[model samples]
Target: MLRTNIFTAWIYRLQHTDLSSKHTAVIAELRILLIDENRQRAESLTSALNNSRYKISHLASPNISLLKQVDEIQPDIIVIDIESPSRDILESVSTLSNYNPKPVVMFSADQNTDTINQYIESGVSAYVVGDIQSERVKPILDAAVARFKAFQKLKVELSDTKQQLVSRNLIDQAKRLLMKKKNLSEDNAFKAMRKTAMDTGQKLEDVAKTLISLLNTI
Candidate 1:
């Protein structure tokens, strides 16, 4: 009886763990902004995308107000159903692209080659034309999100590399000063610098900078 009870408890725990893992694997709810002059079309598009993983909000207004709505909603994706590529629409999206975490997709019913080229050049992540379908929307959204995340990671790495280079340069300069002032070898100077850093609870780079500043003043 004791063995049976232990097995049952283990099985229950295993099932619960599996369920939690599955839930976590599902992407977080995405916020979508639908901009279209045709109220009916916007409503239909919103309904189509209302799945478990997406929380869509929509706006059916003139092009001028659409920009304001986008600022307020701060959507993960913006699906613009353009019948014609109006100058105002293009300008608004162009301005919005300057923002961090820009919108993912822009769609239109009219598929003019020149317009498509312009949209791509303007930093729009993905473009689609004609009646949008579920099959088309999902893949584009996935790619856009992936691309934005990659850009963010690259930016962070670049910033970190720059800081490290600056720190190394400062340390090198400090070591040279110590060798000149104390007649110590490079390794010994570094050791003394490290000891100073440990004693003062200051970073090695900071200590190096301070040493350089003092040397400069003299």
Candidate 2:
């Protein structure tokens, strides 16, 4: 009977935890900057996106310095309508991706597959080719934003994982040193290390790193 009650409580907890995990707020309304050389085309694109959950801004010139304007607005996405790829525009996109959280999307009428691939590899998150339609713009924006957030989250998790692995390596090396220096069995050494960690109110990994550093100095 006790076992059955424990299982029921476990099931209840699992269901509620899964539901909580699914709840993430939709991204806030974004500021968007449209960069294109054609004034009419830029306006059309901006107009299409005006009613979106986005505040649209337009620039009719692809001047490299115009990126500073984007920084001031702190746009969530930068959409570049490229009639043709130029070195200056490519450099600007590369710089923006390295220095900012927001990702850039490149839309080209040229539809040159090789060029589009190059833009994507150069840090443009999404590459849309051909004429832009109002219906398609929002979905593309949504996907690019989602992809960028996922990449950022994965990067943070990877960094955390690397730190954990480094900590574990240090702990294991310290444990081995303790076994050899004290002429103690591995199990006994581990117990001593754990006890010391508890008494010092420090994490085992931290204690291990300190022990290893001390030994190295000696």
Candidate 3:
């Protein structure tokens, strides 16, 4: 019975796989900047993408600076199809990562470990080591979008956590200063800061910073 149940589940998945994977009907509602040296390949990929979902723009030349193009186009996502990425291409992507962050999908033939690592570090969200075909475009794009969103969420959380830590350290420093300057207990110093924050409609950290500055000047 267990074997039969397993077989039935496998059949169910096989039957529904195509239906579940198809994304043509769903609207992605994003602007995609496609960078492809080969015009023929670019057209093929554009045709494959859901017209209702993606607003597509193409850059047929390879030598143009990608950062400038991206700044002008301001696309939500970028897709690059290249045989092997050059140093200029990697540098452009790295600059884009620092300045204008967007999800990047690269379809490249080069599978060298160092090259792939460079691409990742340069902020390529999805890297495919094969031909850029129409049939595979949607799935690859979906994966790229998902990965990009997850990564962005983690980055935001990390930033918030770091800021909280810094604020906490500053508050602690201010509290220590207040305790020493006024000969107040730690609890009293914290209460005084909190009261000032509430009265002035300022944040506790802001009040702490002000207190620290004032105490230091004296």
Candidate 4:
């Protein structure tokens, strides 16, 4: 979390460092998608973002084919600037998170805190309210990317931890079932499980689960 805060603060500083130029070299050669119903606003954002050497694509509105468009474009980051973030729009953003899972920047003219939290939970890396500026684009994009990566790493770690717990539980359950059914000692039961796993070329957890399932059927 500290890393996220420091990275965000650094980006903010980068945005204000040079008032004359939109310093964007940090995010050069990156692909960006701009989703806005308002064509003028989209164009303005595109022009602003383009100055920083980022590739920009525009989506006029959220459609059923939004995911397909995303797959085709393969944007590194997604930028959404809408007057009001509608349900359909939010769903589209959620779908992006579920499917491609990129850093998303959502710029809303105004919104309540509840709706903002919903957006953040649903996958908006940076939820900005009020006017969107050209100078802040590069920094926000970089910060969003950093935050997304950190969150993704945490998610992967959590998933691995959960799987490990499940595996441990399965092994313990298998051992008890062995003791109850075969009258085997705990050490012998574990040895038998390890031996079976080695013989079948399967993981110990998988072998344990399979043995437990087989015994339950008998």
Error of 4 at 174 (Å): 0.5
Candidate 2, residues 185-208, lDDT tens digits: the string is 889878988999999999999999
Give the Cα error of residue 128 in candidate 2, in Å: 0.6
TM-scores of all candidate predictions against the true structure: 0.66, 0.71, 0.73, 0.72
Off by over 4 Å in 2: 1-27, 62-64, 82-98, 114-124, 185-188, 191-204
Query: On a 0 to 1 TM-score scale, where does candidate 2 land against the true structure?
Result: 0.71
Count of residue pairs whose backbone atoms collide, per candidate:
0, 0, 0, 0
Instruction: Compare candidates 1 and 3 on TM-score and give the better one.
Output: 3
Candidate numbers sorted by lDDT from highest down: 4, 3, 2, 1
Q: What order do candidates take by TM-score, descending?
A: 3, 4, 2, 1
Residue 78's lDDT in candidate 4: 79
How does residue 150 of candidate 3 score in lDDT? Answer: 63
Is candidate 1 or 2 superior in lDDT?
2
Q: Which digits, one per residue and each the tens of the lDDT, describe model 3 over residues 96-125? A: 467657787776655452234334333346
Global lDDT of each candidate: 0.65, 0.69, 0.70, 0.71
Give residue 24's lDDT in candidate 4 (0 to 100): 44
Give per-residue CA lDDT, model 1, range 1-218, as digits (tens): 11223223324434554454465565787787766677776766666666746667776654556667667777776666655344356455656577545555666565452234434323445555556566545545555555455566877899999999999999999999989987889999999999999999999999999999987787
Using TM-score as the measure, which candidate wins? 3
Root mean square deviation (Cα) for candidate 1 = 13.0
Q: Local error of candidate 1 at 193, Å?
A: 2.4
